[model samples]
Target: MKRGFLEACVLAAISGEESYGYQIVKDVPASMGLTESTLYPLLKRLEKAGCITARSAEHNGRLRRYYRITDDGRARIEEFLAEWPSVREIYTYVEGAHHDAR
Candidate 1:
């Protein structure tokens, strides 16, 4: 479940434009706890899933891999959005339970 959320976050980060690993880490909120160790593997998974496409380009005399969201990635974002209502309901239920426990 957390993996799905992280993937969605990464997808959304690049939804506006293509980005590299370092930039992606910067683009996502710090609160998300995104790190190089976590990001590279996630990027590979996203690429493997066809949710994004990667290309290498020269930057500062070095090759940088940039990722752009694909049609499937956009569809994924939409799918995640579609699930939000249910997630909200669950959150509401959980929050009520937490309050009751107080």
Candidate 2:
């Protein structure tokens, strides 16, 4: 459940344009707790899923991998946006109930 949301965030970050791994992690919210260890695996998973494409280019005489959003990735973003309202409502309800409990 939460993994889908994480995937959506990664997709959105790369959606702007192809970006390197480090830069992609930077674009994500700090609250996500995304670190290189976490983000690298997630990027590999996304690439394996065909949601995005990774290509290597030489910059400063070193190979750098850049991620680009695919058509499927864009569609995924749309799906996430559509479900966001319901997710928001759930969060609101849970927070209210939890606060009352506290």
Q: Estimate the TM-score of every prediction.
A: 0.95, 0.90
Once fitted onto the true fold, the runs of candidate 1 whose alpha carbons sit more than 4 angstroms away are none
* Residue pairs with clashing backbones, model 1: none
Given candidate 2, what's the lDDT at residue 78?
Answer: 97
Q: Per-residue CA lDDT of candidate 2, range 5-102, in tens?
A: 77888899988889988897798887787788888898899888888999999999999999999998899899999999999999999999999999
Which residues of candidate 2, in runs, are more than 4 Å off?
none
Over the stretch 9-96, how does candidate 1's per-residue lDDT look in tens digits? 9999999999999999998888788998999999998899999999999999999999999999999999999998999999999999
